[model samples]
Target: MNTLNNHENTNILDLPNEMLFAIMNKLSKINVLYSLVDVNRQFDQLIIDSFYIHDLDLTRKSLSGDISPIDKQTLDRIICGKILPRINDKVNKLTVEPLSIERIFHAVDYAQLYSLSLVNFSQEILLRHIIDNAVIHRLMTEQITCLNIQVSDKIRSDFSVKNHSNILSLILFIRENLNDLTFSHWFIGLGLTFFMYKLSSTSCVSSTLTKLSIFVNTFDDCLFLLDRRLESLSTLIINIVQIFDTSANIDNTKLPQLKCFSLASYQRTCSYDSRIVPLLRRMPNIEELTLFLSVIRMESTYIDGIHLHDEILIHVPRLDKLLFSITTILYNINAKIELPSNDDIQRGFIEKEIYQADSYVINDPSK
Candidate 1:
């Protein structure tokens, strides 16, 4: 009787605004908007506030990397209903699965949206977005600054060499307006060679592009962008593998604005440093650099019996921060990364943003 009376006496609406926002932050914003929007006048007004409705995730994903879209009934109700109209203007980032992306875009216009995260889209849909479509024209109205594409397993499995070439062409098309680009979970297929060929042949570039993170067929594929003279590029995280049979040579390309760079090797190679030193030499303005290798034997002598740090600093004159990491490739196709602590940290480098499990400390870029 006392508990029931206490609950009745202290209503949730009586809480302070800050306390209410703090409680709501723990729950999904999507669920919050669905549940509390029509509760009362005060609730409706609060849901549309900039603090609660800036970034909207229209779909949810599981830990094992599966995208679970919202149910169609609820989705249709939300779209035909008053929710989107109420807060559409406040949305800055919209993350949506492909199934509902078209409908969501047509439902309402986001005046302030700048970031679009496209998840699990098929090759056909990806191509559609690139062509002369309503989505492209509508999207161009806003100054799009970022594009995050997560390729679905089905798409990767079905994409042939020609299909993947189309995907690369789409990337080049959309990259003109994008400042930051990120792609997740790429499947290695023979088709990538043709895609790389297209990228290397193209001179089309983005002056606004500043950051890029992608997986490529070979080190030459990664260097294709640098050779094109992407002048505004500042940060890059590339998964690179050097194919021994392929002709890999560093051009006279220079990234004058590049400040941070990270490299991930997909295969085990005995000559990691020998191949990498020339690549670093091209980035004259790099202040922070990270190298992720599949295997590293530190006890062995480096080139010309020189210390690795001295050789790297000699090549990249502006490099003051670096992360040197090694990862183990397992039989199950899973990777186990172990960052050894021997030289870079012993010389007084500190750990910055960790990529995988264990990470090597790096020199400070601010210095």
Candidate 2:
């Protein structure tokens, strides 16, 4: 009876605004708005507040770690029917998967929206909506400043590389104020599949984009993007499927405006010295640099701090932050050469003032 009385006397409305927000933060925006919006005048007013309505994620997450579009019933009754119609102007960012995208966009105009993420749309479906749908096309060209595209499994089954290329061209050229962009797809077992795009002389260029995160097929494709066409680009994050030595014919101008760079290659490469080192040498004004690489056949020498200091770090004088995860696998090991210990690797980094670096040695006797 005492416990029952305590529960009955406690009122959630007595909690402060911060406490209410904290509770809402633990719940989905959809659930918070749907459950609280019509409960009372106070709850309705709270749902309309900028803190609650500014960034809306309309995707449903499963316990198995899959993300999909919200169901039609919730979209109809709560989001489109009640919430969006009430606070569309306050929404600054919106994320939607394929199933809910058309319905939500057709329901109301997010006039204040600047960031949009379209997830799990196939190349065809994505382009059809952006190119054929007048409202979506207008939103992309006129309003959106940041866009993230995560293509669906349809991309894997579809063999039309032209459609993929067209998607890239449309995004880079048509968007008006787009400052940041991420365009990639995740493969089921193989990991990220880098799309191959060939830039052309007649292709339209974007003057507003400052940041880009993309996946490409080759190192030469990286060169094609840095060809002064994206004149305002100051930050680049790229993942290459394969890194190989490129011909010296491409433009090799210094990237003075590039302030940050991140390069990740899941595949092992032998061209770190030939291709990667020279590429890092181009970014003279880089304030931050990150490298994730798996290197093979390095003439039996690991890429220790000494090799990093001598080949790469010394060249970039302005760089203040360096984060790297590099693995070098040697072949044809000589029995006479004594392999460096984990302690020896630490000393190399300590001598260069990189005291936080860590190292370990893994030897596969069967290999």
Candidate 3:
């Protein structure tokens, strides 16, 4: 029998160099620099090698999209004081909010910057940076290849009336060469979803945007986008409130290049129909799929948890992996999942597994 007290305690700092570096990779670089830097010459040298200092998030953020106020003293020490000259050349991805966007540009020339993240920015700042000032335009067109943007104080109830032309223009601008894009907001309304699909209405489809994470408000929004500029989308993540029934058969449309899809539903109190069946029919080539959905088992009508796998396993032509996270409202119970094999499309063999949990990550064979 193994004893609980038999283990030895090892100090993190005393670990091997490789182990130390691995641990450092998991931690926030901002915290690492603030806490561990300048403590010793060895530490400084290790952190300065473009790995820890390459990606920087100058602004503080959280899931709610509220940005922490910038401290002038801290900014002075980080930018004008010591950081610019030390890691300017090494920095490749720099995230800045509207307040410090101009200041950071003036302080350093991140010649190597390939990715840029704009976080917690107001609509006014977005317009100024991209339109009035043209600072963001120049950086985006010339240097950046990947962009992640989170709008500020996203709508909780209402959106103030404003011209959305600038917002549309900025999104179109990024479509030029941006390979990966994440545009998210904390809004609980359908405005953001409408805006996302509106971008696809343009004459030109994005040939470069391969991966995207965005909100989908309705069945129309989903079908409209899947039929438009998102044709080249390979990896997609959808945050949808609900999928409704359509009078017309939607099987004609397809996400031809899509290989990986992740879906999450927000309307928790209501149980949905097997709407994903038609969706999988269109995505015939999907290799991996992940679902984060809430199951509402009301007393009047109870949906068998097996419904999750019943359709997908029988419909989708090819699927290699599946990840699921399901939440229940009335009662909590294990789900019986039916997973298809890697070659199930050809071999025609279906496998059944009883999974007892709220989440699971299942993989294929040939390991």
Best by TM-score: 2
* Residue 192 lDDT (model 3): 52
Question: Across residues 1-367, which tens digit of lDDT does each residue of candidate 1 receive?
Answer: 9999988899788888788888888776767877888898777766778887787888766768677877777777874366888788889988888777767887787878898888777656766775656665557434677877766443343355455566655565655677887765444353233335454455436677789887667666666767645667899888765533345554666667889999887677655555566677777788998877774434342221134445556667777776776542223223333433445333332232222323343323242
lDDT to native, each model: 0.65, 0.82, 0.64
TM-score of the candidate numbered 2?
A: 0.90
Q: Which of 1 and 3 is the better model by TM-score?
A: 1
| lDDT at 69, model 2 | 69
Looking at candidate 2, the ten consecutive residues that score lowest on lDDT are: 152-161
Instruction: For residues 69-187, write the lDDT of model 2, one tens digit per residue.
Output: 67788898888987888888999998898888888999998999999999878777898898898988999989999999987553354454566667877987789689999988665
Give per-residue CA lDDT, model 3, range 41-62, as digits (tens).
Answer: 7787777877667877777655
Best-to-worst ranking by TM-score: 2, 1, 3
Instruction: Give the lowest summed-lDDT range of ten residues in model 1.
Output: 348-357
TM-score of each: 0.76, 0.90, 0.73
lDDT, candidate 1, equals: 0.65
- Ordered list by lDDT, greatest first: 2, 1, 3
Winning candidate number (lDDT): 2
